[model samples]
Target: MHIDLIRTSSKSLPHQISETLSQRISSGLLQQGVRLPSVRSLATALRVSQVTVSKAYDVLEKRGLIYCRQGKGCFVADPEHTRRQEDGRWQDVYDDYLPRAQLWRNFDYSEVKYPFHIAAIHSELLPLKNIGDSFASLVTQQPELMATYGNFQGDLELRGIMRDHLKTRGIALASSDVMITSGTQQGIDLVARTFVGPGDTVYLEAPSYTGAIDVFAGRGAEMIFVPTDSEGMRVDILTRMCDQRPPKLIYTIPTFQNPSGVTMSIAKRQRLLELARSYRCLIVEDDPFSDLYFHAPPPPTIKSMDSEGHVVYMKSFSKVIAPGCRIACVAAGGNILSRLIAAKSASDLGSPLLTQRAVLPFIAGKYETYAAQLRVTLRGRMEKAAKLLKLYAPPGVKYILPEGGLNLWLELPASPDIGKLHELAEQESISFLPGDVCYSAETPSRHIRLCYSQMNETDMEEGLRLFLRLLGRFLQMGS
Candidate 1:
């Protein structure tokens, strides 16, 4: 706990001490509930007066970094919990872009040996040959199409291709019902903008996808959290809540849900559709990783079960096929489809014509072969990673094993400092998505999301072993 301080600097002794301590606490170097050295002890160790230490501790206490326990000692406090107590809570973690981007972007990939925070297939695994060849063929065949602004409702032929793609997943929507967007996030953004407004209620699962959270919250929607389980979003709870306070729209990632990797039961999905119908609300089903299943396929999508236009189905291909293309499709009928198309046109006119044209042929022909091979590779990585963590993780640390999806969701034993864990992992060139950012409510979260497909087998094994050791040490510190 030794801090280097300048004796002759312009900064006051208390300022220097408080600054150092605050940085440590905020960065999670000193995790929540860990006892801090007493005023006298720290003063003596740093060769400072007791009054100076007291002033520094006072500053920290004001910032909700530490709390004094009369007879016991001073301990690190959870800032999020303190904020909640003061009614100064962040309604949504991704209310701002900087905070959201800071959490997920600008990583030094070269230095990071194991970037488990990344939620896409490894570059080596992407269908590079198929993509390049398809793009080249499309560009050569239709040089003028590349210069054109493509359809706002997405390419008709591509929509037809996507319609067939959805058929493989048990969803049967007409090509005319589909609209293309840059990616699934944009699809969600369009939905939020088209329908949701300030103070409008939107129901999303607890610990849901951060991107969707950002979109809905950015639109000023009053986010209501629906708790989830092994079978995914608790439909019973949703049903109970709907009678009390009905949301304008419901957002759900039913299959291989982001961060949690859980799938909603078929019964639950059907019930959800029924509930939404009864309430006269909308359901936005964001289906990202449903196709990445390990063994048995997940239940038919909510959109598939809906005979009426109650569900809006969105799917992304960027994560698995080719990230740079940023291709995704949304299927909605009637005025809802018209509104999204209008929103999409206002946003960017349309997605790149080249990408739409390029992906259509590849998706029509080679995508199944590519996805089949990818599922096998991803499953192997997932199984081995799961085995390693289950064997070595500290007691009380639990995880959900998914039938499909790239992420491995972790539940830590006690609340270990996630900020501190991130800082420590950075030093080891490892990364994982801290579960705090995934929440709509800013609460103390003891969870993490690790993507197994981010690295090769060698890096995955070595990095996960190192990550486990870090967890063991962190838990031991809590003890």
Candidate 2:
């Protein structure tokens, strides 16, 4: 209705009108299924003849830019032409989903020499044989489990086993308090779906897990970033923010947080629980890497301190057992666990019975022995990686040697020309996770996460040799 028409242009009124509307449709200004103004109304608004507007509408209809509904008005059409047409037409109609971890979603790293971007344990260290044997044993003993639908909440035996495991983490839960999910990613998504909504406030660490950031963003939650330090999320800053606008949820990874590899201290954990109690907001504790500690346990999990059922605790076995099994569980005290069960039923009838059963033996008893060996393997890799950094890494690169966790967080020079560094690394088949994706909002990225657990001694050394050289050059260029 608000299109501009030049009176003196040589182009006919109808030709200009159609071109303008077509361009508008081609761009996203007028999205699909939007109703256009009545031809008479548009004609009157432009002070033009109705015939001109009619001609424009006719052209739009023939080209399939829009469809006319009986007794209604012309509406923009779905982007079907994108499939038939080239010239970047697909971009115009694509869903434009942005809440994904860009590294995994966009990159093609199949041929990379050094894949430090990945955060999973090396396949060599995973308990493939144990899990496979467990699978065979389960199928032989319980064929009905493989054939029939599982309880959407999860396997009963698995839940009981997980309940015992939680006792070690200082989280005591009833049988009904625990619900199984595919992994922490799905668990966070379920919690977000159940609690967060548009305009709902959620507090998160500044450099939180990329998956958690994507999940909350996809739910349209207003995320408030609480800064973190060597001890983990700064409860002091969070306290001020909470005083102003109390959030509906506070999500934290108290033990060996991803990307930063920092752990929250016990005092702050207690204070965080206190704040949650004061404000009556739900707290979601994501604890995937807690069992991967090198020297000593980080601290008691925030969930363990919550006696009031204010916390929802998530723990994943993927890091130790196998990511393919996709095993994780959630423990919540209140009726919220029931609501999560409902959401789980809607997600997938249940997680694959095969996978749940496959991980049962490991989680039940075999985990302790396998975990000890896995930790030693990872600690060796971490030590080798640390030595390589000490020998080859340039002066400006700063990092904290974490006690445990897969990633090594590096803080490059403030004027880090990360784009150039990334390009150079890519040329040599070295890949890492840029720190920007770990954040909820745009921040100056002078950080990168390198996973030492993914590569062995020889390969890790060679990859770091090339990477440090390129990084040195990039940092020097910035200076």
Candidate 3:
């Protein structure tokens, strides 16, 4: 119950006192349910004002380390309860549905101040005020939207807006051809659930979006990994695979393809569509990063080349727009679009009407301007990151300066231990997505994906510098 007070430091008396109690609770020195000394007594003993001790206890209670029972004073919270509250036992139920090892797990680095692993736009770059105003307008204009379940196909107005948006990208689609999704991930899941099932064959780029891989694998689909090169997925190899074992679905992120950041050539896009039609395979073209190009626009999407209704196109706004909005749309013709709408109804009735309406104004009005500005900002970040890499990257490190995307894929020296490097990088407060996770198969890779968009210029430089130093040390030791 005794707290040793430091009387001579610049830190306020309350923070130091709170830190001491936090340490005790965390270390188990103060047992759960152990009653703490009364504020009056502790204040008297420490020779500090009662208010300072009261503030300290307030900090502890706020942090869930302690709780006060009015007249009974404060007691240390049950560590078990605190642990449960912080991280629940959801895995107990989840394990029944999927093997714990097979489930897609992403490292949470929210506590890490400098994070390069996240493939998300920094919040500072988001058009928050504009979106906030849109939300406010929705509430003022159509208050009933809050109480109504939207159309199973999504908000009609939002879909119409997306229809026009897709048209600008050379993807001609009507409102009937479009289905709103929570994001590209959900769009992928909806497609997988509608078309793919156990024993169904699915083809994905060797290094593809992990979320899509999880969705297809979760549905018990047998995945065939198609190798990709600087020109994007090797359509020649895919053609060979199609001849051998025609897949039910071919999932691709052809525009600035994920992790590798390579765009498919126009010829490949046309040939891919032709192959899909010939093989009677459905192509799920996930196009999230096409609008993020720095130089000339990427080739026409495979979906754009798909005139035979062979392609299901998904475009996500969560990356370029606000992530919280969770707005994305899928474009398909015929029964595919119809089945996706049915799946959408089964998933959650529909995405939130409120979110759909909130983003409508932005799409209808300032979207083009916002996207232009974002491209400029992101291009600058990409350039800065490229310079840092050139200056600080270790010898034998190789990478393709992405034509336009948020990520840079780095290939370490031959046979380097990525796991050890990851451990050391984490110890230094840096994080990245290892290349193995990007693959559909379980295999070793000496590559890592570094997302530069999430970090500001300063943190990005510092994190890369630290990573380079650690990488060099690790390589030297191996040599």
Candidate 4:
């Protein structure tokens, strides 16, 4: 390697050198399997100490941008990876967002301390060891389950256990009524495919799950937003919408909804069911966080109150259990179940039987116990986070005390553009989901969602403190 060919400023030698070298390898100027010079030799050529070159190479190797063999010199690593690495420049890979909007789809997580990761309503308090043991047992006893495709309806054992479990939630159904999915998101997609089509009207909560909104729009459904408050989706507005062009489907997260942790009242659930049946519309109820309640016992799902079989209920073990397990269930009513099954069969034969077996222990009786434990733990964490926010929330922000679930929705006092907040947070290594991103409509933006699930009491406090600090600074700068 030529010494003068590589150049960097001594002011920040290691970082500059690393970036320069990363650019070369990533841009293919340095081809894969091309050996890097010896650390001392490169240092001498660049007029830097051996330690600086060594440190740069160390960072490159750790990032998988380059690799070092035992005796062979370090060489450029895979550059064609679809996903970028920790040291990657996301803007180089994906198109950039506008002035102040958050281009979150391009977020790189490795280097971020907290990076305001408030988009996913997931919890880190998952049952790993117990579930892992169950998986091992399945592999040992029912090894054939892995080799064969799962039944279209899912593992019969899991479905049976789930049927009994649903009884406690007041949703009465049999194994035949249920189908396993990759997650609630896929369940929502399958339901969308089953009932909706191009130009079909679909009713959505004003700020619903972004993924669901994307799925519905991707299917070419014309979305109409029904306003939502603390009580959940406005039934009166929905009733009016039904009178007009009745929506083909209504998507809602009734219990402990994402972004806003509002659980619908029983009266609203009944009204929604009535509206669905009256209009002959399908109600796709996502209740993944119903089990993570910290307030009063959660109300019965819309499916339970359905008399006309208009509701399609979906839940996931991903939030409560391990996310990677990819175990989810959906209970369909009317002819929707059959259509969903057909769509699901086309989407993928079925969810894995091994995943089903791994979650059986939870479905049988263990998940309930584990869930109870998690609720208590989460309640404590939520309290801590609330206290921190209440104490340290910067002067132009407002937030509600969530009833249950992993996220906190905040309304910025001055309505700063999301692009500004995203940029500031990105600089601070913090990431968050601005509420506007969740909306499918054009409205004045002033909201953000904070996830408190992954962080402990300390991280929650620190995260909230950092968030308030950043927002306060933004308000001052008026950027």
How many pairs of residues collide in model 3?
A: 0
Per-prediction TM-score to the true structure, in the order listed: 0.80, 0.81, 0.79, 0.77
- Runs of candidate 2 exceeding 4 Å displacement: 1-91, 94-103
Clashing pairs in 3: none
1-479 per-residue lDDT for model 1 (tens digits): 56655565345778767865664454344557666788988898779999999999898888678898788778778754332232432332112222122222324355787888878788888987888998888778879987798889988999999999898778888888998889898898899989997557789998788788767755656677899999999999988887777879999999998989999999999999999889888999999998899998889999999888999999998767888899999999998899889988999988899888888877888888988888999999998998898778878888878899998899997668887888888898888888866765536678998888888888888899899898888888878
Residue pairs in clash, model 4: 100-419, 101-419, 115-430, 115-431, 116-430, 116-431, 116-432
Residue ranges of candidate 1 with Cα displaced over 4 Å: 1-110
- Model with the higher TM-score, candidate 2 or 3: 2
The whole-model lDDT of each prediction reads: 0.82, 0.81, 0.81, 0.75
Q: Which residue runs does candidate 3 get wrong by more than 4 Å?
A: 1-95, 99-104
Model 3 scores a C-alpha lDDT of 0.81
lDDT (Cα, tens digit) per residue for candidate 3, span 382-418: 8888888888888999999988879999998888778
lDDT of 4 by residue, 5-82 (tens): 213212256764675566445334465656667787778867889999989899888867788777766777755523
What is the C-alpha lDDT profile of model 2 across 1-479, one tens digit per residue? 55545464445778767755664554345667766788888888889988989998998898777888778878888755222234665554343333333434324576898988878887878889988898888789988776888889888999999999988778888778899898888999999998887557889998888788778766756677899999999999999998877879999988888889999999999999999999998999999888888998789988888888899999998756898778899999768898998998999888888788888887888898888877788888889889989988899789999888898999987766565677789899999888867775534467898998777667887898889888887777777
| lDDT winner between candidates 1 and 4 | 1
The residue pairs in collision within model 1 are none
Residue 1, candidate 3: alpha-carbon lDDT: 42
By TM-score, highest first, what's the ranking? 2, 1, 3, 4
Candidate 2 all-Cα RMSD: 10.7
Give candidate 4 regions above 4 Å deviation: 1-110, 118-124
